[model samples]
Target chain A: MLAKRIIPCLDVDKGRVVKGKKFQDIQDIADPVELALRYNHEGADELVFYDITASHEERKTFLDIVEKVAATINIPFTVGGGIRSVEDIYQALQSGADKVSINSAAITNPTLIETAASKFGSQCIVLSIDAKEINTGKWNVFQNGGRIDTGLDAIEWALEGERLGAGELVINSIDVDGVKKGYNLQLTKTIANAVYIPIVASGGAGIMEDFYQVLHSDIADAALAASVFHYNTISIPALKNYLVEKSVPVRSVPSCQLY
Target chain B: MIAIVDYGAGNIKSLQIALTTLSIESTLTRDETVIRDSNAIILPGVGAFQDAMHQLRSDNLDKILQEQAAAGKPILGICLGMQLFYETSNEGGLSTGLGLIKGKIERINANVKVPHMGWNTLQIRRNKHITTNIPDQTYVYFVHSYYATDIDNDDLIATSQHGENIPALVQHNNIIGMQFHPEKSGDVGMQLIKNFWEMVS
Candidate 1:
């Protein structure tokens, strides 16, 4: 059986890890590479680098950082944000990223999904959707960092992504993002039941119990958290141990061993 | 020196980085002479079987790899490269593979997810030198939709349970195949690579 993945997302802006209200406050928590190394040693199943910076020069630095991180860590790494074309995807993969996540760009050009998946096997393309609940039992898809509402139904959009050849779907809940309440289980389960591809539930992971709830509920293949992990509020090794106690089948390093 | 046979696979950079971290010198090349003269050859790939085979044949790497294998050179195939060692694959059509091992590649049909991505424990089938250092049931990363099936049981060395018993490791004399990416599988994977390195040395 494949173990449930625990991912630490690094939201990078202007070559720095940023968070807080409106994502304006640039927190000097730690260097992205150093934080990545810590997660690698601490047993993070994967690392996600979301380049919030849109400038071409910053993108180059992001790819350079990607090369450094890939050279240092021995786990799967995913690069996303500002990836609009197949060329960007190729650049990221060539820079040592194991997978590339497509968001707003995927909506502007649905053909990008097919082009990328066909060019580089579906295993390398991840379709990340930012969804916000508008009415009872309804959610709308958002793009451009959740600033534009596309009016596409979340479930329908997920199916479309699968049809377009996305290997996996990262359904991020804009309603619950940065709130640290819990994952939007209803939205995640709806999409998971709709698509056969693996679904990674992102946003609103406050405690280990939040991870246990979503993973144990069978609504998500993986749980992604940023602030909790970045701010040192939760430790990955400890969280894995907690999940093990709950019988959640998460990979863990031995007590005294980490390489 | 180890020559990582490059056929435009996605993992070339990370694979080379993994070897460097282990202090093992290696080169990514398509030159027939380099691959033919290396201490060991690694066929690394990540793509559709037909496309990868097409690339290999177009570049004449298929002939070179077969020649090296015939000469008793240790050859290790990773992921899609592993699938290429079989007789045929059912991906994107019934494409033929390099007939180095007697097997057929088929889609994983055990009612589980198609890709079977993430970490899983290895079920060691044979007590081989390549399985040394790494303890039984240690978790390793995997990412693929198709798997090797109908292989000679004698060639099978290890299996990992994902929807079904997917072949994790196989060895037939000088040829070896690993379904998972040892480069991205962290410490346990590094140990497996080190074991393969020892075999060639």
Candidate 2:
């Protein structure tokens, strides 16, 4: 059985993590590379580092951060935010990211996904969606960090992502941004049910039960949260242990779970 | 000194950093003499099998690894390197492997996730000396689509569940292979590497 993964996503801008409050006003958090190391030590299954605007700004800082993150941490890290081309993906992979995620670029140039998948293998690419609910009970797609609405249905766009060579899909709920109320389980489940690829549920994780809620749900393959993990409100090892004891099917280092 | 065969595959530095953490001196090299003289050999790799195999073949390190494994001095392969220890690979129109293990590498069934990428807990089915009776279920990190499948049950030391029965650890006497990245697996990973280092000591 594949263990359900709990990921911590750090949205980095200019090397500092910024959590978009309501997917708008961004606030400084911490140095991304240091945070990455902390999460790696804390037993995070995997990490997502979105260099929020690497594509637009052409910030070379991501590479430096990635190289250091790769050197300092041992866990698998995925680099995203402004990855528009195969060459960009290759550069990130060379910088030590286990995977590269694409957003706006893939929407603009769907062939970039095919080219990247063919060159680096589909497993290296992750299709991320910043989703917001719209009228008529349908969710709309947002790019450039939810600032631009593409008027695309979330589910259809997700299927296109998988079709265009995305190995995984990250359905990040813009509505649940920093709420800590719980995850947008229904939205996550919707995407997970739609795609054959592994789906990582992101946004609105407030408690340990939220983690379980996502993992036990039929639609989610993984759950990702930020503030809770960064603040140590609940430790990943503890959460994993609790889930393991509950027989919810989670992966945890042996000693931590047993004790 | 231990020799880490780095043929521009994966992050070879992780292993070097791991060795440093273990206080075990090592050098990253493709030099035959450096590899031949080292007390132990480690083959670390990632990326596509065909491209990685091409680099190894071009460097002529495949023959060296084959000879070294045959000599029965501890030789460990991680991830793609572990797949290379098999008889042949289904990757890219079939390529010959180092034949260190009597098995072939095949693609994982597409029904399950294509790349079984994530953290998976290890079930130590066989109580072997290398594992040192570490608890039955230990979590380790993994990131690969293909695994040594339909393998002989005897060769399997540990396993991870992911729809397909993934071999967490495999050993044929002194030649050992781990499907996960022990270097990046944190404490559990470091302990496994520490155990491997102990084998040479």
Q: Pick the candidate with the highest TM-score.
A: 1
Give model 1's docking category. Answer: medium
Cα lDDT tens digits, model 2, B1-201, are 889997887557678877887798998899999999999999888778888888999999999998998887799899998999998899878988888888889888756776787777788878776787357777787878888976778889999987788887999889889999998777778778888888997
For each candidate, what is the lDDT? 0.90, 0.83
User: Model 1 chain B: which ten-residue window has the lowest total lDDT?
Assistant: B129-138
Off by over 4 Å in 2: A22-24, A53-58, A135-137, A254-259
Candidate 1 per-residue lDDT over residues A187-247, each given as its tens digit = 9999999999999999999988899989996699999999899888999988999999999
Question: Cα miss at A113, model 1 (Å)?
Answer: 0.5
lDDT of 1 by residue, B1-201 (tens): 999987888768888988998899999899988887899989998989998999999999888888889899999999999999999999978989999999999999887877888899888888898988777788999999999999999999999998888999999999999999999998888888888988997
Error of 1 at B12 (Å): 1.0
Clashing pairs in 1: none
Interface RMSD of 2: 3.7
Model 2 residue pairs with clashes: none
Q: What is the DockQ of candidate 2?
A: 0.44
